[model samples]
Target: MDSPHGAAVKAEDFGLKGPRGWAFRGVGIDAAPGSLIAVEGPSGSGRTCLLLALTGRMKPTAGHAEVGGHQLPKKMSAVRRIAALGPVSGVTDLDQALTVAEQLREGALLQRHYGAPVRAMLRPRAERRAAAEARIASALEAAGLDLAALPKGERTSVRDLERLESVRLSVAIALLGSPGLLALDDLDLKLSDTERAEAWALLRSVAARGITVLAVCSEAPADALVLRTGPVDPDAPDAPQDAPDAPVEAAEPAGAEGDTKNDTTNDDTNDDTKGADDALAEAGRA
Candidate 1:
């Protein structure tokens, strides 16, 4: 729960639509500070859309919502400042080519550049670097992740990370922002029953520390507040797990982030990865 920091979420008639049809409609919810909200629904059920809408990454075409008492749609930019995205595909996906250390370093640089206070940003390069390291250490501890456990430790590539490890890494990266609300997509995608339980437990612990969590999954644990966008139709044909929303409004990158209104594609993503790689290499030399 939030006392000093955290966001409460409330919505009334929340909905969004694209050119093709309605993404989601007529949804309402009220979650206290530090609540674990599960956006549970089958694939193609607009779960991801709802998740983005709540986090101020995507605009809602209808009704109103609030985060930490800051209203949505109208107060989207303010909402974005306190809400951080984790593991949202086409939004915050990890580059398979980048190692764990590189990812952390790049995110730290961006967090300091764009999200840190003016005084913090004015620090000398060495001091800034040390602060980043401390932030990474604190985030990793909160995420229950240890680099020493990996085969190559910090050098492990994103492609080589286990499903749960990826989740933890994503959570850590977002936590680097010191957000009041953390939102993640595809929370239990490829995990076994045991791993699924562990994921929920980690989220619960994070919530215990007073940061609200919003997770998207096909199934939600009993402890979370379930917000269903639509019912699962087992009879219908299956949809691919990671299909992007139809004409999805482009989302901001974890680095160089400003607003999520710009359009981006695969080619744009490659450029970002190359830029991060170059920056990281330069940082390593210094």
Candidate 2:
């Protein structure tokens, strides 16, 4: 869209614990505005949790972070306003039933209605519609998504998109908000070597445009600022005895409140699933 106006992102001693263990802990990152950062770890290592925590989609139990000039936990609402999530399973998942064009239209509309200034909303209907179209066009161009290249063009359902196409679509939608920081999950999941290269290049281009990018990947690429996560040391004195059973969901409307209950058993199931997936990958490599 417009020239980059990326905001600096920083975290110190950031940690998030769940009942199963520390989803991620002792994490620290100092990324300048417009930097490309990769959170690298195998499944169950809490990469997703880290992504959510940085984007203000999940709360951190300890430590502190600043995103887009907003202090997290304290100014989470403000952080959420300047940061956007793409393809974060529980946070920004695309609707499978929708067509690519439909998704783009909806994302632009949501951004305009939820993120635009009140003065902008007071504009004439035709002008607002035109502005939305301009934004979608800019995002599409910047994301390098050619909707017409898809099998069914813009009418292609999200369920039908190839892995790379889905990634591009999600990036395009996230761009509609013109956010200062963007977070994406599963950056390299299910992609061939060539596709992986393309994805990395795309992300690099995004960073070059002035949007700080935080991505979750199974392995970090050579070009990114990397953060590696490991299993929690239970014997450590700082180990948390009580932790959230599940991750807190994304932000609700301002002033809205919700409670997250502990379900340690469910947490175990999630851990098991992640472990199994990691095992399968390891076996395939062997």
Candidate 3:
């Protein structure tokens, strides 16, 4: 991987509504390509939904956004092609059963099959195989994952690896596509202070390589661009303060398409599950 090109990300008045209520609204952000961006918020603040929507995995009800010059929602499919997900918990989980090598090999195969350029695919079988191998190696290097560091080297099972290793593996897998944007969740989960520092360093290195990185974290890094998320307050001076009872939504899929059939502004139903559920539901539509 000679450093995949990154995508510029921009959003304005971006918002989403679920059956329960608005996940987030009036959101604004601007980041250059190859920038390291941190999405900061509490558990149910719609951090995950914003990640999904920007990557073309979810839809927004109000406002608009662009990733890599492609408008969101309308160009979601295109964004999906340029964006790859990493460690999104419920959305993208590693198979605990697979060995490290197996996981990397599987990712390589998927990228070769679905994301390969026509010219590359036209190469001889052996050349193609070598190319995939090279790609896997490059991704592993870029992700700072060294197989020899594992107890059993390439044969180490995912379940046996530390949380940080798992994140590295997921990131490597996402890099197989050499995507313009890489989105990850829970960047600081289950890590000590030292580990968290190392994790941020890894992300910085990735961004330096020209891949825009969107990471979700409870604590925003001091150096990276930060995007904050929180429960939307309808009473905020800037919000529809007239809506006295608009409730903030929690983070969980309540059902498919949170009240897509209804106006999300009627979204003040004080339900949290609906937005997450709606995000999940709309994600499938992508």
Give the best candidate by lDDT. 3
Model 1 Cα lDDT, one tens digit per residue, 117-142? 68877789899888789889988988
TM-score winner? 2
How high is the lDDT of residue 135 in model 3? Answer: 86
**The CA-based lDDT of model 3 is what?**
0.76
Weakest 10 consecutive residues of candidate 1 by summed lDDT? 263-272
lDDT of 3 by residue, 159-232 (tens): 99999999999999988888899999889999999999999999999999999999999998899999998767
Tell me the lDDT of candidate 1. 0.73
Ranking by TM-score: 2, 3, 1
Show the lowest summed lDDT stretch of 10 residues, model 2. Answer: 260-269
Please, what's the RMSD in Å of model 2? 6.1
Which model is ahead, 2 or 3, in terms of lDDT?
3
Residue 278 Cα positional deviation in candidate 1, in Å, after optimal superposition: 29
Cα lDDT tens digits for candidate 2, 1-286: 5565787999988876645556667788899999999999877767777776787656677778898788866766677777777666544667999999899998887777677777988999999988888888898887889988888999999999998888888888888877788788888999999999999999999999999999989888998999986666766655342345433444321112232222122221224445223322322222
Q: Cα deviation in Å at residue 231, candidate 2?
A: 1.1
lDDT of model 3 at position 174: 89
Collision count for each candidate, in order: 0, 0, 6
Error of 3 at 78 (Å): 1.0
Compute each candidate's TM-score over C-alphas: 0.82, 0.85, 0.85
